[model samples]
Target: MTFKGVHRLLLLVFMGLALAGCQTEDTPAKPQFVSTTSDSRNSNYFIEFRSRYALSYGHTYVVFGRTDGSGQMINPEVAGLHPKSTSAVPYVIGHFVPVPAETGWSDGDLEEPYRSASWRVMLSQAEYNKVVRKIRDLQANSKFWQAALYNCNAFTGDVARSMGYSVPPIQLRPQEFVTKLREMNEGRRSVSPSRVLTAS
Candidate 1:
């Protein structure tokens, strides 16, 4: 192809991406997950580890259910640790001291546009209900977010642990945390990471 032809192709690609980004800048994208359970019929329950960009470092959360949509559409349940106030002040303060936290969904969490990585695992009906109960208990008990102590990653780890999954050290960033969780439990069953994270 001529130089002009190549240039035009690249321009079109860039423009298409730009338009797509703008359209989703304020909306949540629907989540599409493929269950790892061999028996798709019996495995209607699932929990997905997800990561997305955030101002401090990044954020990680879980989306659960047999939901067919996201945002307000399917309204799948989500759990993550985040400052109760959306303002940046409390978050910055939390680095040194614990601040109020909310354990449920936050804006953009259900959206795929901001996601960096995802790993999903299927669960049996009994396990699914148990995990949901654990999540709710954690939310009620967890009232603060502290960077060095308890934060989003810690919150996620606690939820995964209830399902008998081996959890990495909570100091790692959100993206790394979810990636490591999946790697540790590769067989769709609770297992261990090849190497544990000793330090951040």
Candidate 2:
């Protein structure tokens, strides 16, 4: 082969190697969603639009209504309850809702008046992972709930925001946040709370 031809072949080989290196360097690994196997019943949960709500570790799993029409957090031991065919399925509400303090009210007064209502939502493993990741991210960054109140519901809203969902103000009343989540989940384009209120 001529010297010039040999030089051209070397250049081509060098270019190929550089291209291969660039491709390898630019490729990103597939993102792995959070683990679903950690909790067994996670898969059966259905994603649905309902009244807005939140989830947290403290209010891990709760039965929101009667067994005939209720939802519970996914757990390894108990199969989650859903709405009966004949009845409206009770929601699987998260623990993120804040519990109000009892202010000198009688037990009877507290029992009927202050009981918070909840709705349910079931999420697939991927969706659950997304929510979990968002929550962890917010917990790592914020102090709003650290000292004043440990509002899981607000934390859940923060997570929702991280997942690209429009959320109400981070400092909103629990009912308002719930209203916003419900609205957003139902394909509504509601205004997000001002970003100023969210934790940095």
For all candidates, the clash counts are 1, 6
lDDT of 1 by residue, 1-200 (tens): 99999988866664443233223221232243333443333456777788786655578888877644331224468999888997999977776568999998998887666786677666566666777888889989999987767878889989888766778867666666677777776564541233221210
Q: How far off is residue 113 in model 2, in Å?
A: 8.6
Model 2 regions more than 4 Å off? 1-42, 45-70, 74-119, 144-154, 188-200
- lDDT of every predicted structure (CA atoms): 0.68, 0.32
TM-score of 1: 0.72
Candidate 2 lDDT by residue in tens digits, 144-176: 322013333444554455545565543333334
Evaluate residue 81 in candidate 1 and report its C-alpha lDDT on the 0 to 100 scale. 89
Which prediction has the highest TM-score against the true structure?
Answer: 1
